[model samples]
Target: MVKKNNASNKSGNFKTNTIYAGDCIEAMNRLPEGSIDLIFADPPYNLQLGGDLHRPDNSRVDGVDDNWDKFSNFRAYDDFTHDWLKSARRVLKHNGSLWVIGSYHNIFRVGSVLQDLGYWLLNDIVWRKSNPMPNFRGTRFTNAHETLIWCARSKDARYTFNYDAMKNMNDGLQMRSDWTLPLCTGDERLKGEDGNKLHPTQKPESLLYRVIMAATKPGDIVLDPFF
Candidate 1:
C-alpha cells in the first residue's frame, strides 16, 4: 500500500513500505533527519532526442520521451540532481547507503554531483541487459548497459554489505561489478488499460532484488525517491 505523510510528528516518526506521490525533494524534506536506512534512485536521463525513432521495419520504437525526462539544459539538470542528492543525504542514517542508476547520457554528471555532496564512492556497477533492444538505425553500437553507483553516507561510515549472501547468490563466487539482467518486459512490465507500459523506465525487479539483498538485512528500510 502507498503511504502519504505531510510532515513528521513531534516525536519525528516516519512511515515505511508506503509509496508517496509527489515531488521527491519535497516529500523527502518532510521526513525526519536520519530516518532512512537505504535509498535507490532512478532519476531522469535527460535524453535529447531530435525526432521519432523507428526500427528497420518502420515500426516506432518506444523510447524514454516522457515529459518528466525533459530538461531545459545541462545546467538545469545538474541543479536538479544536486538538490535531490542533498535532500537524500539529509534523511539518510549515518551508516546508510545510496544507489543511483543512469545511462551514459547523465551518469557522469550524476557521479560528479554525488562526489561534490561528499557521498563516498563504493562501486560503480554495470547492468548489462541480456535482451537489449537492437539499435535499428545502426548509427552506434547497441546501447546494452546502464550504470549504477553505490555509495555510503560518508567515508568512515560502517555500512552493510552482504558479502556472503552475494557469493552464495553467485554460486560461491564473489559477485563482481558487472551484473547481467533482463529488461522489464512480458508480464513483468506493468501495463495500462491500452496495453501500453505504465512507466517507460520501469526497472526489472530482479535488479532491485539483488541490490536490496546485497546491501540490506531483513526489516531494513529501503527508500526509492523516484518511485
Candidate 2:
C-alpha cells in the first residue's frame, strides 16, 4: 500500500501512511480540502515553563523546555494553535472527525477555540494515568490525567462511530468518557545515548492503538498533523 515518499524509508501507504517529520500547518495546506477522513492531533501543551525546573533536592526535573515547546506567551501559543487547527479543518472531509489531547494547562482554551470555530463536540474524554508523577513538593494534587476532545467537522456532518466495536473491546460494556491507562514505562520508553528518554512527550502506543482502531476502519484516511 505504500506509495508517496514524504520521507526516506517511509512511504505514505495508499497516501495513508505517516509522514515522519514536517511543519504540520504547511504540510496540511498542500492536502486538498475534504480529503482527510479523520485527524488526531497532539499539539503543544503551552506549559509556559521557564529555566530549569528543579526538584527540592536541586536536581533538575526533566521538562518540555525544547524550542518546539517555547512560545512568546499565551497569546502567541493560542495563535499558533488556531492556525494549525484551521489548516486541519480545511483538509478534513465533511464527515471527518478530529481528536486532540492536552493537559489542564491548555485544554480549556483549546475547547473554547474549537467551539468558536464551529466544530460540534461529540465527547470530552479523560485519559487517567495509573502511575502519574507525584507532586514532588506536595504543593498541589498530582496531575494524573489528560483530556481529549472529539468533534465532527461541523454541526450537521455525518461521522463514523463504531459503537459495537467499542463495546466489544470494553469487555462487552459500553466504553465511557474516562479511560484508564498507564504511561509509557520500562522498555516502551524511548532512550537516548545515555539511556534517558529520547522524546520528552511520546504518548503510549497502547493509547494510539485504541484510538486508531476505534475511530478508523481498514482503509480510512487518518491524518495525524503532529507526525
Candidate 3:
C-alpha cells in the first residue's frame, strides 16, 4: 500500500500507508496506543568512529560516520535507545512484535534496553554478509555479520510467526538463526547527487523480505521508526 498525500494525524488515530516525519518517540506517542502490528527498527547504531579509516592503498574508506549515528557517550546512547524502545512498547499491539538490527557496536546495549523495558526475549538471528567489507588493517576478523534481535510484546503475548513460509524459503529445512545474504549495493542502494550512498548502513531488501514474511501477514501495518 502507498501513503496518500492527504493522510492526516487525527487524535488517537493514524491513517494507513503514511510516513510520519519527526523524532520517532514523539511520532509514536502521538499515535493511538497499541495500534501497530509490527515494528522493524534500523535505529542509529552510534558507531562512534575514532578517526577516518583507510585501506591498504591509503584510499579513504567511507564508513558509518553519519551525524545520526554519533552519540556523546554510552550513557547518552543508552538514553536514546531507551526512549524510543519505551515509546515503541507503547505503540505496539499486545500481540505485536519488533525486530531490531545492529552491529556489535550497539546491539548489546540495545538488547539490555529492550529487556529492561519488558520485551520478552526471542531469537537472535545472525545475518552473514556474503561480501562483507574486510577489516582493512587486519586488526580483527572480517566483520562479516550483523545481528537481528526479534522480540514479542510480552511473555504471554501470542505473536505472528509464519513457520511454513520461512521453511519454504529454506527449501523445507527448518529455518535457523543464521542467515546468509549480501549487503546492499548496486542500484538497490540509494545514492546522493554526488553518487555516494545516501545512508551508511542501508540493509538489503532480501533481508527485509524474510523479516516481513516471517512476522506479518498481508495488510498488516508495519512501522519503521528510523526510516
Candidate 4:
C-alpha cells in the first residue's frame, strides 16, 4: 500500500518519498526556502463540462467531472494557480526545475503565469496519448494530448537535464518535444473499493518516471504539489 503523510505542521519537517495529503499551497508554504530540488505539478484543467457525456452506444462517459476540477470562473482558477505556483517557487532551490502538466483548458494561463513569476521557459512537452478517447459526439477533434511546461526558477539558474538518459529512453535518438505514451490502464491503474478509478486524472507512471529521470538525480528531492 502507498503510504500517505498528512502534513499539518508548520515547522517544514518533510521527508523524502512520502506522499503528503493537504492543500498544496499551504503545504509548500510550510517548507523552507530553497529546500526542494524539483517539483512536478498536475493541476486541474478546469474542464467546464455542460452536461453528461455519452458514447455512441449511449453509455455514459466517465469524464473528469470531479468537484476539485470546478471553479467559479477563469479568474478564480488563475488565483488558485498563482498562489500554489508562488509557494512552489519559494520552496524550490535556485538551481532546481519545475514541471507542470495540463490540457488546453488551462495550460495557456499556466504558462503565462509562470513567465510572469520569472520562471525561464525551457520546453513545452506534448504528451501524445497513443490510445485517447474518441469524441463520440463528433463535435470536435479527439483531445489526444496534454502539455507539460518545464522551467527553471530564473533565466540564469543552472538546472539538471539528463540528455543522455532521455536519448537512451528514445532508442539512441534525441527525444523531441513530442512524447508518445499510452494512457493509464490495465493493472497499472489504481482502483477504489468500488472497482472504479481512484483518481479521475491519474497520470501514467511512465510519464512521471520519464520526467523524474530527465530532471533529477537519484538522491535529489522531488516534490509533487498535486500528488
Estimate the overall C-alpha local distance difference test score of candidate 1. 0.91
TM-score of each candidate structure, all chains considered together? 0.95, 0.90, 0.94, 0.97
Supply the global lDDT for candidate 3: 0.91
Give the total clashing residue pairs for model 4. Answer: 0
Q: Candidate 2 — worst ten consecutive residues by lDDT sum?
A: 5-14
User: Model 3, range 1-227, lDDT digits (tens) per residue?
Assistant: 76533223445787777777666788888888899999999999888789999999999999988888889899999999999999999999999999999999999999999999999978999999999999998988999999999999999989999999999999999999999999998899999999988888889999999999999988988989887
Residue 198 of candidate 4: its Cα lDDT?
Answer: 88
Q: Which regions of candidate 3 deviate over 4 angstroms?
A: 1-11
Q: lDDT at 80 for candidate 3? A: 96
Judging by lDDT, tell me the better candidate of 2 and 4. 4
Clash pairs for candidate 3: none
Maximum-lDDT candidate: 4
| Error at 78, model 4, angstroms | 0.6
Q: What's the true lDDT of residue 34 in model 3? A: 91
- lDDT of each residue in 127-194, candidate 2, tens digit only: 99998977877878999999999999999988888888889989999989899999999999999889
lDDT of each: 0.91, 0.84, 0.91, 0.92
Answer with 2 or 3, whichever has the higher TM-score. Answer: 3
Worst 10 residues of 1 by lDDT: 5-14
lDDT value, candidate 2, whole model: 0.84
Query: In every candidate, how many clashes are there?
Result: 0, 1, 0, 0
Candidate 2 stretches with Cα past 4 Å from truth are 1-14, 55-58
Residue 114 in model 1: lDDT: 96
